[model samples]
Every structure is written in C-alpha cells, then in structure tokens.
Target chain A: MRSWWRVLGVVLGVSVLFVGAWAEKLVVIGPWSGAEADPFVAVLDAFKAKTGIDYEYRTMRAEDLSKVLPAQFGAGMAPGDVIFMWGWWIAKFADHMADLSDVIADVPFAYVSPLVVDGRTVGVPYVVFVKPGFWYRKSFFAEHGLKPPTSWPDFISLLKRIKAIPGIEDAAASGDGVGWPLSDTTEHFILAYGGVNTFLGLIDGTIKWESPEVRAVFENYLIPYLDYASEPIEWTSALDLWWEGKYGIYFMGNWITGMVDDPSDLGVFALPGAKAVTGGPDIFFVPKYSKNLEAAKKLAAFLMSKEGQELRAAGGGKLVVRADVSPTAYPPAERALMKALEGFTLVSDMDDTIGGEWQAAFWDQLKLLWVKPGALDDVLRVLDEKFPKG
Target chain B: MRSSPRAEPRGKGEGKSRRGLPLLFWRSSRRREEWVAALGFLAIGLVLIGFFVIWPSIRTLWFSLFDAEGFAGVRNFARLFGDREIVDLVRFLRREPPWGALLHNLVWIVIHLPFTVGLGLILAVVFSKIRSWWVGIARGAIYLGIVTPLIVGGVIIRFLFDKHAGMAPQILGALGAPVPWSAGWTAYPETALLALVIGSIWLWTGFSMVLHSAGLSTIDRELYEAAQIDGASELAQFRYITLPLLRPVTLVVAAMTFLWELKIFDIVYVATMGGPGGASNVLALEMYFSAFRELDPYRASAIATLITLFSLPVGYWFARRRLRR
Candidate 1:
C-alpha cells in the first residue's frame, strides 16, 4: 500500500506540471485561415523561437469576431489572448480592450489613428491588404491576346471581348456574400467616376448616397458593363470561377495573391484615371480578459516590430504599414504592385471604416443594384434613408 | 375494540390547532409528502426556466427601451415603425418584392403555411389508406427533409434553385420556359423569397405530415364506416368524420407551424442571408443583423420583443385550447 501511494503521488505531480504548461500557451485568434494564415503563423513561429512562449492559432471570420467578442467580453471572458480585429471593431469595443499606447508608442500616431478611439490607443497596426483592382490569370489573358485596359472605354471593350469567349457567360463574375465584394467593385467605379473628394465625402457623410454624381457612376459606367443577371457567388467561389476561366476578371483585394495556388499566374490592375484604392491595416488588440496579458502584449509588440513586419511582408500577399520596413522584403510581383500603388492615393476601406448600419445598408443596396439595375433610384433613396446625411 | 396504533387519534387541543391553519398546511402527512415530492421534482426545471427564458426576456424588454445614447424611452420602438429596413410600405406600394424584412416574413408565412399544412394532410390521409411496403419508403423519403438539419436543408435549397446545377432551373429550361433568373433563383429579388418559401415547404411538410399521421391513427375507423353506411361519399366522409375528429391535431400542427414560421431564422440565414437585396429578409435575420452587424443591441432587443409579441397570441391560444380540452 505504501509503495502504490508513492507511485500515484509521482504520477499526479507530473500530470499537474503538464497541465500548467498547457495553460501557459497563448491562444491567438485572427481572420486568417489556410494560405492567408501561413505568413502570420511564420511570424508567430519566430516569436515562439525567440521568447519560448508557445501559441495556439485559432481561425475566425472577421465578421464573426464582432458578433462573438462582445458577448464574451460581457461575460468577462475572451476567446483568445491576442485577437486580430477590424479597426472599426477595435473602436467599438475599446473599453474592453487593453490600452496598447505603451506598446505602440514608437509607432506614428497618424498611421494608428484608426486603431485609436477617444484619445486611447486600443489596437496595434501590423500589415495592410490593398483592394487594388481586378485579378486575371496571365495565361488566360495571353492566350486570348488580351491586355489590361488603361481607359474606361477600353475596359468595357475588354469585358465585351471576354463575354464573346465560348463557354463564358458573364464578362466579370461579381463576388458576393453579404455583398461586400460587389460593393468593393462598385466603390472602384465611384472613385473612378465620382473622384477622390466624392469618395472621401461619402465615407465622412458629407456627400449623400443619392447625389447625382454617385448616380451617374451607376447609371452610366457600371450598369452597362456589369453582368447584373449573373448570380452572386461567394467571394472564394468567384475566385475559383475566375481561375477556371469561367470569368475573365475578379475584383478583389491583393490578399488573393496568398490564396492562389501560383502567384505568378495572377495579374492585377486598377481602373484607369482612378487615383485612389481602398486599403487598411489588419489591427490586433489584446482583450483585458486575456489570461496571458503580458505574453499577449509581448506577441503584439513583436508583430509591430520592424523585424516581424519584414517577415510578414516577405511572406507576400500583404504590405507592411511600417515605412521603416524595406520594400525589398516583398517578392518581385508584390514589388511591382507596390510600385503601381505609389501613383494612386490610398484610402481606408469605406464600408469597413464606416461600419455599423451604414455598412450593412451599403452592402445591401449594392447587391440590389447588381440584381435590379433599374432600381438605382430606389436603391439610392433607401441608402440615403438608412444612412442620412447630418 | 381498541384503536390500532397507526390510527391513534390526536388530542382535541392539537387537532383544533391544526384545523386553525390553512387546509394545505393541515393536510394529512401523506398528502404533505406528495406535495413535497412534486415541488422537489419541479424545482430544477423552474429554476432553469426562470434563469434562461424569463430573465433574459425581461432584460431584452429593458434593453429595448434604451438606444446608444441611453434611456430613450419608446424611441427604439418608434424607429422600428419608421425604419425602412424594418418596414417599408412605400416600396410595397411601388410593387417591389422586398418591401422590408417584416413584410418579407409575412410573405414567407402567407406562402409557407397553406402548402405545408395542406400537403401534409393530403400525404397523411393518402398514406393511411395505402397498405403496402412502398408506403413506408415513400413516407420515409418525405420525412427525411424534417430529420435533416435546417442548415443543411438551406444549402440544399440553394443548390435546388441554382441555374446551372439545380434541377428546377434545368427542368424549366427543358420545358422551353423563359428562365429570368440566370444567376440562380436565390440571386434575384423577384425569385429569392419565393424560392426560399418553396424550399421551406419541402422542409416543413414532413413535420406536419408526421403529426397528422399520428392523429389519423388515434381516429376511430368506425366513424368513417358510419358515414359510409349513411351514403356519404369519400369527400363528405372526410369532411364529416376525419376533419371533425382531427381538430385537436390540426390545431396543434397549425399553432406549432405558425410559431415556427414566425421564428424562422436558420434556413433563411444559411440560404439567402435575407438578401439579393433584402428580398428574402425576415424579422429574425434582421434582429441578428441589428445586434451583431450593426452593433445595436437596443434595436435587436426591440426586434426580439416584437417577435415575442407576435408569437405570444398563437402560443396562448394553443395552450388555452389544450387546457380546455
């Protein structure tokens, strides 16, 4: 009996130690999965190697974070130690978030403005994904003797050419799901036709959605060219269709480069004379309820560090928001895209920035526009009603 | 004879004191034990209901009274009436398929109710008449829709209406009909709500059928025989005998179906997401969007309150009928 008791004590002691070690591993949640998660995981691996603090990466949808986190916070619990969030969400849930001003003190205040709320820095900026323009397969374009258009008329002609191709139904496949992809495509047209001031005005609520300038963009440019009858495919599925040569072009963010099987086969271009593109940093914040706050802050600090940003930028499909991070850190194709983006002004993603009811209304109205191009008047009226000017 | 020890009488003063208390308190010891046992059995369930259902409901009601700025009495409710996203009578006048989320739900209930209930009754009665092994197979196939998770059913509905891959569109194409929804039925405003409604009918018909099937089993065959002997036709026999006899079952089915229709969320959420421009938007989906997407718990609470209010009458009526019976 005495010998058995001694053995049991030894086993119990070892089990407790293992449990303690398991509990110490930091849990991190972000909106990246599969290919998009690979680069971020590399950054985490580096952190683990340096600090010996292990982490578990949990993938969550960006939209779901807003829905789930609030309830969790209300219950004084958090799903993970470090959470990658939209800037708008960070602003919304600022109270529940830990103050990160000390961590990102050296970073420029202007670059992190979106992550700040009511004079408190609640989030840290890491990397930005640019919604540059449409992506097409280089091989397909080459096979059909097609070149990226540099003019509005030329773009329309290119769409027509693609439509004439056998087995292709629509000129461009409108990616959808809560209608954000279609809204992104529509915003490009608004920027192209309505100009930069109008785009900015719409975001700040200075310009009305029902304004004639915005109406003309829809009436004249998008409706005639866009295949409104084409079914709304999920964004990823739309990517697949575009990849299979079912559609000629897909308007999406530069993140697609990471998602694609081969980055070299992809080519992207913005609207001609459209001197603005939507892009913003993927902000991460530490919840106050995090079990491993000190370690979480350390991981967050590492992510914003020049070394970490360089690793992420080198991974491709993302651009470092930090100017100190060298452009040479990017691949050749990413470097070319970065060079192209230099000519245009970069703006935060409109829907993501002006999120809440206005964002939902914008997505819905754009989906409406896609289906019933004639309902432009109704759609605009409804948009204005949902998001009335001050 | 001497009194048995079990039946020994109490003193007059003690009996008088016990009688002075309420009848419940003065009940026999065995009766008191029965009451204690019943209360003990009910304690956990009552606590759970109080915590989970009643408390949350009260909190939701309180939350609905406030907005972002705080303590805006009736303002949120007023917004519900005025908000075009919640209720748009103007668009309805304009003859649009999507007037608003509330109207879309009404459209769902109006279209979904009849087909599900009617088809279910027809199937149950027809199946009852059949005496073959094939009948079980047929019933099982129809019931499969109910057994399948609604989330899966919603996905099935999406493919069922798909233009290229779905059977409905292909059949329409083969029939030489003009298919207006080239994208898929769920992709267009004109067809999205109707498509979901049709899909719901497929999902819910099995539920009502099983209920009616059980109801049919309890119904005495002698009533039908009496009607037949009196020269009543099959239709008349059904009207006079089966219909009257199945009143309780029909009431239960209709009441449950109505409540289900009012709270329909998962299928719509999974399928159209109340989209193709809010054409298929329902109240529950709107409540979710208001809470999570819009980050307005106040508005969500107001919508939840409205859904509960709408469901209360149906639930009450069903409960009242069941109690009266």
Candidate 2:
C-alpha cells in the first residue's frame, strides 16, 4: 500500500508540472464565416506547429464583426488579436485597429496604398477582385454584324443592335433581380462621366446626388441597360443567356470570369475607359484589445511574404500589394481581361474612408434614382440635409 | 397530570447535558429547509434573469443615446420622430397595410394557428381512442416536421416552390399557365409568407398535438359515458365537456403562436432576406437593419424596446389567466 501511494504521488507531480508549462491560447476574430476563404485557419495552424502556441478563432457576419468587436473589447470579452475586414467595414472601425507601419514596410507600395487609413498602414493586403467593363460574345457580335463599342454611346448602339435581333434576348438583362450589376455600372458611369474626383466627392460628403454629371451619368449609363432589361431578367437567366450565346453584353467585375470562362472558349472586354477604379486593398486589422497582438503581427507578416502570397494566388485571388507582380500574377488564361488592356487610366474607388456614413447616404440616394425617375431632386434635397456642404 | 409526570428530578450535571443537546438541534433546524428551497430557487432565478434579460436590456438602452456627433441625448429619438420617411412608414399602421409585413403574420396566426391547434386536438383524441401501428405512423409523420429544424424545412419548401422544376410549378404548368410564384412584388411577398406558414404549421402542429394529447388524458372517460347516457350528441359532448376542459391548452397554444409571430425573424431572414424591395420587412428585420446594416444603434434599441413594451401587457394577462385556470 505504501509503494502504490508513492507511485500515485509521482504521477500527480508530473501532471502538475505539465499543466504549468501550457501556453495561453489566443482568440482571433474576423468576418469570414460563410463562403470566403478561411486564410486565418490555414496560416495559424502552421504558426502554432512552429511556435508551440495555440489559437481559437471565432467569426461573425461580415457586418457584425465591426459593430460587435468594439463592444466586445469594452465589455472585457476576449478581444481578437488579428482581424480580417473588407475595405468599407475597416473604415467604419478604423479607430480600434492598431498601426502596423513598422511591420508592413517590407510590403510593396501597390498593395500597401489601398490598406493605408489616415496615412497609417493599418493591415496587410491579401486578396482583391476588381470590377471592370464587360462585352458580349465576339461570335454573336460578328453574326449580328456588330462591332465592339469603344464608348458609352457605341455600347448603347450595340444594345440597340441586340434588341433589333428578333429571336435573340435583349442585352444581358437583370431587371427584377438584386441589380448588383446595375448598381456597379451606375457607380462606374458616375466615375466615367463625372470623373473619379466627383465620385470621391460623393464618398467624402462633398457632392450632392442632383449634380448634372450625376444625373447625366444615370440617364446615359443605366437608363439604356434598364430599357434593355424590360423582360424582368433574373441573374441566373442572364448568365445562362450569356453562356448560350444569346445575349450581347454585361458590365461586371473579374469575379464573373468564372461564369464567362469555359473549358471550350470565351470572349472578354474592358469597360470603355472614360474612367476607371484604380486602387482598393483587402485589409486586415489587429484589434486594440487583441490579447495576442504579437502573434497576430507575426501571422500578418507571414501572409505578406512570398510564400504566403503564393498561397493567396493559389486560393484564386489577385495579389494587390506585390509591385513586381503585374496583372500576370496568375497565368494568361486566368488573367482578367482588364489587366490585359493597355492605355486604360486606373483611378481608385472613391475615398470611402473619409467618413463611413457618407457611402450609406450615397447608396440610399442612388437607389431612389434607380427606382423613381422623378425622385432625383428629392433625393438630392435629402442629401443636402444630411451632408450640407456636399 | 404533566406536573406529576415530571416530579422526579435528575442530577444537575445530567440536566445541563440534556439542555446543551436540545440547544444544538434548535440552532441548525430553523435554517435547514430555507437553505435548500428558498435560497436555491432565488439563486437560479437571479442567474437566469440577470443573464438573459437584465444584461441585454442594459446594453440596448445604453446604445440608444448616441449619434454621429457622439453622445447626443434624445437626439436619435427626436430625429426618428422627425424623419418623414419613418413617419410615412408608421402611417401604414393606421392604413390598409397597417402592421406592414406583420399583417401577414397576424393573418398567419388567425388562419394557421387554429387549423394546427384544431387538427392537433382532433388527432390527439383519435390517437387516444385507437391503439395500433397506425397511431405510431401518424405520430411519426407529424413529429417528422418537429424533428426537422426550421432551416431544413425552409430549404425543402424552397425546392417545392421552385419556379421551374418545383412540384407545385410542374403540376400547375401541366394544368394551365404556370404561375411564376416568386416573380413580382405581389407574388413574392405572398409566396414567401405562404411558404413560412406551411413550414411553421407543419413544424409546430405536432408540438401542439402532444400538448393536447396530455390535456386529453386528464379527462376521465366516465364523463364521456355520462354524456352519452344523457343522449348528448358527439358535437354537443365536445362543445360542453371536451372544449371547456381543453380551454387552458388552447389558450396556451394561442399565446405561444401570438408570441412566435411577433418575432418570426429566422425563417424570413433565411428564405427571402426581407426582399422584393422591403415587402417582407417585419419589425424584427427592421430592428436588425437599423442596428447592424444601417449602423444606427439608437433606432434599433428603440425598436427592441417598443417590441418589449408591446409584449408586456399580453404576457401579464397570460400569467394572470394561466394561474387562474
């Protein structure tokens, strides 16, 4: 009995020593819960194996991450050491993210510029998908005796041609759908005609919705598309028609490449470059209350490294930060058509970081313009009330 | 007589020892019952109330004070009242579309709740009478929906109502001009509401049935035999005996439905996203939009507070009436 008790004492002592040596686990929170690539899990697992540190990750809805994180920190809940956020959402919660200027200096300028907030490097840029101009099937254009339109008017003419074709469906339509394409097109139109500065003004709360340029952009840019979409076109139908060689054009981003590109064949085009969106970065942040700030920094640094960047490219996204890596970041076939085109002036998306509420106002007013024809002035009036100088 | 029984006196030492024993027993006995029952219940009730109710209420109330300029007392509320669009939205309360999408929910409660509760009661009565494998099959079929989560049911409903290959669409197409169930604004809201009703009715009716079954078991068969002896018809027996006895269960089911309808957020969120241009924007969605999407915590809190205030009176009435029954 004495010998058995001695053995139990030895076992208990060893267990106590083992428990004492355990490392504190870090909790990293972000907004990649549903469909987006979970980059954190991939990189963190490797870091843990190397450093003998463990991490716990939790995710909320993309929008909720910003709203809840601030309070989580204030309320003494476990704060996220690292955060992955979209450009617009990051701007809303900028005050809480730590400055990483010293950490991200090795990152290339192209990638770093978009992620910078208020002249401070807040996070590393990882993945980006830019929206650009699109065109109809080259074969369809030829059979219909149509030419590739260079300008917005020529684009309208192409639409007219497709409408003239009796059996063919109207230009890739999206009437009753969410109209995301129309929304994107409307912003581009505003930029193209009113200039990128005007769009920037809209973001900074300096431009009203009733400006002639804004009105002209809508009347010229979206009215023609909406007219073509008289058949209550859903997005699925539009994509199918485009794929089946039944439609003319679609103004969408490079993400739509997966839709348009096929194993057999495909056609692509850049928007008529009257104006273009130049820069925007996929941003990550370290929360102010992050318990594992050092670990998060290490992870962010790894993500920006060549090996980490390769992982990003493999995950099917453009590396925005690599200066040497051009649009040829991926293979030629994988290259978005926008990257191939020359002499296209690229201006960044409107400065959404100036104030978060500005974009909400702009989107609200823009919705009115799209739905109600005569409601522009009223929307503009509301804009004045909200953002007086703008 | 008592004095005579205690006449024999013990030694002083023995008497002192006996007094000490009784004193020790007296000290612990008073607290034993209360320590187990009262303190335990108080601790549990405090924990639940503190965690669930008090915490969220405090957080929501705190968020209602701020604005773009920072902390602005009553500013958000003043602005909410002043905003013409919000005012116009509220005006629908008095008009034909009063209660907005909540109108669909009210209609849902009125139509679906009764059917579900009535069917449940009748089936419960039937199951009580019949003793066979059919009873097992019937119970399983009803409970299949209860076992399935609302989201799973929603997906099934979505497929069933799909425009092209859906069972409804295919059947209707073969008959005549196939209805595009999710096409326009009118059809979109109506179809969404209908889908929710079907999912809700199918999922929840089984629950009501189980409740009614238990309620029915307590009813003595002798009463039914008595009714029969008095020559009371089946309908009359149900009206006089069964219905009166089942009032408490029916009331509980009705209240549950009413509360469920008021905050039917998940089904609507998953199915339609309050879409086809704000056609299905119920109070819950509106609160979420204000709080999360719009990033206006003030308005969201006010909306939540309104919902809480609205339910209080009904909840109080339920407590009173339920206790009486």
DockQ of 2: 0.15
Summarize candidate 2's per-residue lDDT along B48-114 as a digit string, tens digits: 9999999989887677776667787777666655654333456455432213444555656777778
- Model 1 quality (TM-score): 0.90
Candidate 2 structure quality by residue, lDDT tens digits, A1-390: 999999999999998876655335666665454323354466667667867777777775444465576567567543567766666666666666777777777767553464567987666666555655654566777677977679867777777878888766556544223334444556667766778778777766567666776767666666655666433334555566666756566655554444444512445555465556544555677776566677677767776666566545543424445665555445443454544544555554452343244434444344334434445565566555655232
Best by TM-score: 1
lDDT of 1 by residue, B45-136 (tens): 99999999999999999999999788989888898989776788987888767878888888888888988988999899999999999999
What are the per-candidate TM-scores when only chain A is compared?
0.93, 0.74
Residue B150 lDDT in candidate 1: 92
**Residue A287 displacement in candidate 1 (angstroms):** 0.3
Against the native complex, each candidate's DockQ, computed on alpha carbons, is 0.57, 0.15
Maximum-DockQ candidate: 1
lDDT value, residue A365 of candidate 1: 75
Q: Give Cα distance to truth, residue B224, candidate 2, Å.
A: 4.5
